[model samples]
Target: MFEFFPGDHVRSSSVNLALMAGGSLADIGRWLGPLRDTPEAGLDAWAAAWAGMAHQQEALAAGDVRAGYLAAAGRRYLRASVYHATAQRQIPPGPTKSESYAASLQAFGNAMDCGALPLVRVHVDSPDGTLPGYLIAPDAADPRPVVIVYGGLDLTKEMLYATVGAAFARRGITCLVIDTPGTGELIRLRGVPSRPDYEVPTAAIIDHLQARHDVDARHVAVLGVSFGGYYAARSAAFEPRVSACVSWAGSWDCGALWRRRWDEAEAEPTSWFLPWVTGTGTIEEALERLELWTLADVWPRVTQPLLIVHGENDREIPVADARRAFEAAGSADKRLHVFAAAGGGAEHIQSDDPAPALDLIAEWLSLRMPVLPEPPVPALA
Candidate 1:
């Protein structure tokens, strides 16, 4: 949509494709690039978009579709970069709403509790790490089918605690929210970079989920939110243990993400993107760093019950990327939902409206996986 947006223009810095010998392209193909005209302008768009996100967020209560608002968010500031040579303009983040973020999630969860959803926090360990995660479970059980939820690039496991936890808790199903690579405190404290090979870490999560005897091994499922949509789906494809998978706001590759940032900031050949280029690519020859994580490599292998949900208006990741992922999945049971409201569905998850989407997910999980009731709490050990 940025292509069609009035003020938006694709920044040349988005795609610095070097041609190869003969007519053949390099294995790392040069496709589409970023959208920002320049970092200064991107800042303006960011400010405008951020200013109105809260209103659309409120729209969820009123049953907005979500895709439109999401698109507006994208079209508004599709250019924003951490690159810092000399920003043309900087959109100062308004009153830190980390509190608002938490409150909104909590309020949603509380509403669920009022209706009898059971949510609990548990300690989970990933091979070399341990983290806190929320568990949403049905009441009463001999065994339970559990779903592990992984969220997108910008979200923390804490951010999902309310969304995923509350969503599943209401369904009487166990939903676990974990901080994987490139996300939240995990990335902050642990120098773990996001890997194209997502299963490496998720395998560790599965180990933790299965350790609980109350969890039904046959029915364990995995879900990814936003960028996590790719990771969770990829993991489900390789891990024989996963019975079903859901990609909520998915993308086909990480390459697109970085490229989008470049365009949003209009960083091509511009000093503003030096920091991002340095962090993700090869300014310093960092040993373990890689820029683009493509889904073309992982999609061919996925074979599980799958569901993909995306807002047509997503500005951050073009909806086309999500469509590519959905098309690539080999799963015979795959499903795709492109949300299109007046403002847009779940605007890249800061959706003006999220309940309908969440409700849809919960419903699908219920229909696809048989619910296992929570087992009685063991008498104090």
Candidate 2:
């Protein structure tokens, strides 16, 4: 991975995420240049720099909208949203974090409106609560296979859309980027914490998708990125409706992973992330709660077609997890693809170079699911 901050893993990861979301390198360089002398622990400085950039982009977007340059406005708003989300990621859980997150969501929504993107905000009723998501559907009206995408520890549905959902839609696949329990809107806004039984929420999301006229429910797939890899695997293990499953840098046992981290005395870059996401007050409590999140017993139950993608140099989840997942999965049609560090995409979720990973996933899906036909070109006005 290219480190924007030499020794600051947290800030460097944020940089990769920003780029993955289509942020401009020039603009990011300008925003972060002055903070070069700042220490790795200078979270406030990092947040301030990103927040300032977000404000500027928001202002530019406003001007573009007023000038009737809708496309330009959309582009600006998307940049602003990425900036706000980056700032939000650096802050601790508090009013400031809340404000930054809300700004990100607002900017993302504005981008959708200005661009007239083929996406819709959806809310599904789950036993836990309301699951908020964005559905990016292809232009064609025909029933299409849909993939439900869940993000990791700190990712929002909007970020998923910006990073991967739109690409899936362009491949003629309906992409539903959701905020399941424990992440995104549910965790940040509604105080929902991550649960061990992810299949419950997965079932709810599938139920909602099955009711949609534009979706081919029989061909639904579940994909999880980062920590969400656990969610995807767990869901497919129990949810019979899920025809396929993909785990992008997921884990075999998150609890054991945390324990290893603790034993190795390696602190998580974001100190507050685990406790907050797990709804625990301390690291010990969080570890105890995560014990039930393992897929050891469940992997054998995942009979659907499975694809596990991992980065050989992923600093977060170990590549061995992917291998173990593949070996244990009950699916007769299962494959594991590992990107070598030399080939790029060896970082977590292939953030270093996501193109190859993304292309592979799109092609893999095309082989197993029914892709919608390309929409006819419209007559010139």
Candidate 3:
């Protein structure tokens, strides 16, 4: 709700989100240099600025790849993907939205293809069709623990990897970044709606992981962001195979939040996003569908180790939700960490800078995951 652009909360938040999703300060400066001072910036203006920057990056990325500059190409492609995603979020579900989303996915694919890391595209069969996923291994030769990461609400799978999945991989953890039902390609392309029973998809993901020889199924974990916090908690509560769980923002009772937001009547972009994700035609219908999103009944069922991380200044989901979820969980090994402004993680998911939060999550998961064998010491002969 805080506005960096005087009266434009949406534009301001979009800029912050773009940076959080891996946009560079230089890119932001170039994109917003002209429009930041202009009054009454509309959505079209917002989309156009980001889209123009994204196209330029994409072109440079292609040229870099052709010139055998793989690393440079990867970085440019990643930036372009984030910019396209930012532009797509500003627009609604229409041709322009679809076009930007497609461009974002394509750029992400190009980034992966540049071989910056060993990221492979995976598709899991679901009732709706195939769910797109990216499988990144910490080491191809070793069997490592995997974390299935998904985004909340409007987040795309590319943004999830840009923010968290890459960090996990760097810390010796395998990551499966998926566009689950009701999100990303599933919603924008296949028309899948939000399901309270996230374990259904979680089960499919576990099955996919188990079938792979590189994964240590015994230590598999699920982590979710924003509204996805609710999905991860629900899956951990019901799915016996999930060894651990993390609620990035701790969505204990999303239905209650919906009710409150509806009554408040500000009608942010989410007022449209919620219904679209839930496959409802209106907010009233979406709220009715969201009745199943509460975690009151599910908390007692979570027997695995649980981690709840919340921001002290989180305006969307209050820090109290983390406390409530932690208290209700049956996990004896549960822990609650509230990052305050002093620690640089007080913002939601540590958007101002994700390093601290990513480091915390990676360290936490490292301790719980199956240990890998250490390298042999070289002989001094």
Candidate 1 local lDDT, residue 162: 36
Ranking by TM-score: 2, 3, 1
lDDT of 2: 0.86
lDDT of 1: 0.55
Model 2 regions lying over 4 Å from their true place: 372-381
Q: 103-131 in candidate 3: lDDT tens per residue?
A: 99888888878976468788887666788
Candidate 2 versus the native: TM-score?
Answer: 0.95
Q: What is the C-alpha lDDT of each candidate?
A: 0.55, 0.86, 0.83
Worst 10 residues of 3 by lDDT: 1-10
lDDT of 2 at 231: 92
Per-residue lDDT tens digits for candidate 1, residues 1-381, read 212223433321111101100011221121111113334545444333332343333344223223544432321121111111011112222232233333334433433333333446566676547665666665655666788888665455544653444567567567777767666445444545466667777777677777777667568788887778878877886787888888887668666566656656643434322333224554223222334467776776778878888887776577888788888888888888888856446355425456677788888987888774546689987
Evaluated against the true structure, the overall lDDT of model 3 is 0.83
Sort order, lDDT high to low: 2, 3, 1
Predicted model with the maximum TM-score: 2
**Candidate 3 wrongly placed segments (more than 4 Å):** 1-4, 373-381
